[model samples]
Target: MAKPPPQPPQEPPQGGFGAPQDPRSGSTDGPSGYGYPPKQPSGQPGYGYPQPQGHAPQTPPPPGAAPGYGYPGPPQPGYGYPGRQPYGQQPYGQQPYGMYPQGTYPGGIPPQGGRSNQRMMIVISAAVAVVLVIAGGVWFANSNDGGKDDVAGTSGGSRGSEDGGGTDPTEGGGERPADADAKAVLQVPYPSSVPVDSMLVPGQWATAKTYAKPSVYSITGYHADTGKKAWKLPLDGQVCASSRHVTADGRTAVVFQERKMSSDSSSEPCNQIAVIDLDAGRKLWQKKLPGDRVYSTGLSLTISGNTVASAWIGGSAGYSITGKELWKSASYRGCRPRGYGGGKALVAVTDCGSGIDNEYKVQKIDPATGRAKWSFAAPKGLKNVNVISTDPVVVAVGAGSVSTTDIMSLDDKGKLRARLSLERPEHGQPKYDPNCRIDTESCVTVAVDKDNLYLPSEEHQGKSQYGDTNEIIAFDLGTGKPKWKSDAGEKRTILPLRMDGDTLIAYRQPTLDSGGQVVGIETGSGKQTVYLRLPNETSESERRLAPGYGTGALYVNGRLFMSRDSIRKNSTYDKELALAFGS
Candidate 1:
């Protein structure tokens, strides 16, 4: 018999005081849930063993044992796990807090229910960066026969064009010199006195000249190659959210509170929106949102061409790049706009109905007219919808059994072309991690090119007795079939960052004795070339700063920038908020 749907956890108290326990720990020794922990002796506790509160401890599966089939439990925190207050209670569609909503946030994990599923999801550490610790590989084992039907188009062209425009650090210039030594070129310290709870600080962008990151109440631009601060733009209150897109000329948007919260008794509404010039480090314009309620929550922002869009639990609106109102959409067809996926195209995810009848619709919106170019209805009984790629129109949906069960690809007509199952009978439970958080369009570990989708296999015990490793696999978007697999050498695991022309630029996690590396994999030939290698001395810091499930990473020119998506007061790793590594 099918199990009943899990109940949502209780709403957490606001003001950061009623933060819930991590709930991810297994044995008392340490956190053994996420990532591939090394195997221990028979009597010792092993990795991947997760025990619910007051329940008997679970053990790892025996080596080479056929894994049992089960569904995914709630999202487990990967790295720098944010507190549970902002991530749970709300689910996806409901308006939990009104306009003055205090702690609701997107980007990582939906709130889990009280009952635990016997099933376990094998996940790597949730860094905005994917890290797999191993020691044996020098290069990806290239296969001559990878994608036989490689698609050709201009969509995945030069990195500069794909990402709006600016300057291409690697345009006329070839790759960075082979011997280029990477060191810490920039580092930002965490703010002091931040309550020991999760706070939104979610923006990171790079241009030819500047690398911009958001702090508590302001955003700062730093010299791309040097660590010097170029300019800082302060706001009246906290930065609640930031658009991942930048205009061709270097402008972007963010949502902030109207007034600063000065005490636990006071609250501010996250209804103020603004556009800023990343290069000049100044606000281009600011405006107030309409119909904000005192207790409403949930907001997501994105940019497509000349449109800057915002969606919440009750309504969604769009504005011109210069801040002129474009259109407003409220509840329609018993559904409201929840979020959007932008860039290359504009798409919206609308939540419809309630309870088991809950359904989601993905609509391709006309950026200027705010009309649906086409709409695709997702399968019923799904809990969340995450837009992975807008240009190709791929979405990740979680149904009754798994957090993310299927990845659906759509054609230009908004018709389903392929559906790739993450939970395969052969693999037992889900084995691939697209690394999507709760926010729409926040899948980080997955990338889509013209014809193929790229994702990392789950980390598992490698050849070395104590090490774990995984690989990047390519699948055809049209047929939903495997195209090729590129192993991440011996010890290290690699993740897709973005496509640079025909090459897929990826980051390789560091090993114990070495620093991390940025490599370019030629999609056609399956060739891998090291682009940048950090010094061995900074390996420790590189591990902590890598972007994966919950953070952000940007590779421009020859420089790579990594920063935390959200900040908490108790971070122990030098309180380093951001880091830039380059020669």
Candidate 2:
């Protein structure tokens, strides 16, 4: 038969986390590529053991014979013996003691081919045994040392010394001393089992728990200064998703929930919104959505005194928090819906049509009354548009061939004051387009501070190189121009951009190798402080995963609550389904 063609080499997923696929072979169900072998059965002979079926007879050695001295007594008939001895000569082919001829056997064994095969075999075995012993010793040493080198390094205020040396106080540490004006804040502990999401009010203490018996999730407010649960209220159905929006005075908090089918069948969706008063834990009101609606992709309830505007996207409509119909529109065929920022004005975006040509429509609406403040068709080439912030300025991002990002300052009348455009390079050069062949363009995700905007770009290279790279660029809000660009060195899916006083807290889903690290980037100097780093041993599949943020506390309230999976093991569908429904 003709030889089969050689198979092409498989490529591992770049930067790691994704589906639980193989690293080397890209196989999801095959053996792990981490170099450890599968478990072996007990009592099975291993390595160099001889098979039992082979035919061989062994003659016992004489007393005091060394371990590998071979057979004693005399050689049997038909076996080669030295000196061509006749039968019965010197007692059955055995050489006479002290009369054995010189050169009869060199090195304690007759030559097989000018060299003693037996001696050669002994030497080879000894060498192999020595090598194995050394290798095992090295492995044992590393195991005892915990497999990491404690190299002398520096972090924060002090020099980090290795196990072998004392830290030098004169060397400048890699990290600056903690700001004397800043206080070391301790994060308050919530229920260890609760799936706490993003914080709505930072530095303030709040407690939330999912009550399975009543199929409702409740949020209890606590004074950040006092650490006491002030009030608790339950929403209407079991909450699959929820968020907390605080009133301007920071005294009142509105806990919003979307009704969904029981955990038994998550596919059965409902269109209802429930609101609870944070101070009294009372059900303020509940509104039935006007048609069969899927749960909202994004929900926000912002209050300006008595005027509260709740923004949600679902049921093919966008509505205010009071269950008042704001604007009814057709649902985007394949894209997820989003609603953001509701003060005097509201901004919403939805997929316009189907196919790859689909575009997003961004509209501004009056919050007091469901009135269209202004509407603008984002550039047709753009795929997604989102409002970054409402106060100071209103910035919206539009992704396109080279992501035409526009930052607009909207006046109270919804009139555009100043507009700034940011264009990402399609290729290293103007004419060479890498995404053209792949039929995909790069996307720019926006992160906003008070007067600075951070735009993260996802650039695609060809197959032979790193497929995607992340870059963050800072744009000045006043001039609407570029400030400084910083490369994140890894592809990261950014979460909500948060401001902790003057510090900006940004969460990113980093590429696989680094695990997921939440970083606090100083918006002033663009320096980053790692707030949290997950354990490195986490599987690549789970490490690349993102979690949903629900009602939680932020930094201002003296606590930060984040939800992430702590453990995952393979299981059957029946087992997983049962666990998901708490059965």
Candidate 3:
């Protein structure tokens, strides 16, 4: 792929965790390994699961073993509550993302090349997942230094968490918006949602982890119907795509991002986190992930109730949204972080010299202190059982192979109560798209309620454009019994985004030619109740028939929120969003 055409640098305000560190330019004035503590093992010992009988002796797959390299095979979804669309924020100390080489798509759009999917996600919990949109492509790592730095606004570790003061502004009192169709909403400025001009470039949004850049990053609250920017709050780092949320209370938000720092000409990559108390319209606290156990802080940045937790290479740690360190621990040999149960339980994988041959135990720890309380060991063959959910006790699941997986629900005391099996896509199929479950053989896209668990079926295999069925299979959580299969088997298949109450919110494939509808399906039985056909641009790109650059539709309360962020087909990401809301 050719590099993007160079244009004169537009000097903008310097924003984010600090200054930009594009290693490609040979400027190494940033932090790389500073402030990081040495790795230490957890205090617990000899934690093992009873091996299952009659199964091939398991061992972690050898290097270069399987054709796939994503989140530990099938069944492992990017961490967090099963349906939160999160990527593990375990900060496993993976090398920093590479620079975007100079390249431009002939059509001004990146060519839809064959990029390999996110083959392996080594981390704990859910907070920052790469939404791998698997279309055809080679898995290449590169970034674009399309920005020039200038000092702007005030931020970085230098800013006090309480800088916003007691005078709050955005929406501090836990109140919803007055407009019936609009809920609490926020829009962060540029670089927050960078465009992958060419499809060949890995689709991971550069916005998720940009260090200091040319523009001051910001979050602006907007009036629902008028498209007015109500208020703007500045921050020092880019927001992680997987960990951005506008809560129901309308008063708070959690922003996750990666940062690089330098001391004495040596640089280190670190996780920059902040709690944006919307009411104050300023940050409550802004700090680097703390504690010796919190290595790789960005790996699993999850917010469960009042607590926020991070899993990393050194270990996993929990914190209060106010920036208080609640607990931390060092994970022993081969043990990996899983998910947080919000004051209920914290789960992690244990005993894996090699993930396969070993009988992996899934241990539940005290949410406050990282102390091992109980463990549910996997039966033989079901290696490396990763805990996925805590809302309803513990749902530990693992991929037996690329095509098969095992899902088991364990009781509070670590007793295996039920198990189920599901099918998944092969190594290089389109479903491997990060958007399709972060480029894994399978995605942990199951939606569970008090009584049932809903899982979307793989996009119908084979030729597109006809007879393709996109489905959500519902199963009883207690008995692991199949309930019903709801599908959108129409001309243009719809994508099931998430579960809202007893209904499923789905968006029809957007096209340049016509408007699209946000369809609401009944979870009990696959029935379409609400079909709101939106404006043409609600899902379409300004220049082509394809879906807009960062297009996605979510159903909130009585309104449908559609966001389209693109710089190619359109001049700016914000305009696309405002245009989509054209009333």
Models 1 onward score TM values of: 0.71, 0.42, 0.53
Q: Residue 227, candidate 1: how far off, in angstroms?
A: 1.8
- The numbered model that scores best in lDDT is 1
lDDT of each: 0.58, 0.31, 0.34
User: Which window of 10 residues has the lowest lDDT sum in candidate 3?
Assistant: 97-106
Candidate 1 wrong stretches, greater than 4 Å: 1-180, 264-266, 294-297, 330-333, 424-428
Cα distance off (Å), candidate 2, residue 238: 3.4
lDDT of model 2 at position 572: 15
Q: For residues 1-583, could you state the per-residue lDDT of candidate 2 as single tens digits?
A: 8533222213211212122233456654321231211111112222221111100111112233322222121122233423311110111111111111211110111100101101112110111110111111100000011111111001111111111111110111113223312221222233332222111111122222211111124444444334344556555433322322333322222322353324321333334555444445555556654444343223333332233333333323333334444444333334323444433234444344443343444445334333334544333433334455444435444332222234455434333344444321322111111111000111112445557656443333323233234434455654554555443444443332355545555444435455444456666665566664544343132221232111111222222333221111121110100000000
lDDT of 3 by residue, 106-215 (tens): 01111110111121222232222222122232211112121212111111222112101111111122122243232222332323333322111111111111111112
Segments in model 2 whose C-alpha atoms lie over 4 Å from true places: 1-236, 240-244, 249-267, 279-282, 292-340, 343-345, 350-360, 392-446, 456-472, 478-480, 485-496, 500-553, 564-583
The superposed Cα distance between candidate 1 and the true structure at residue 479, in angstroms, equals: 2.0
Root-mean-square deviation of Cα positions for candidate 1 versus the true structure, in angstroms = 16.7
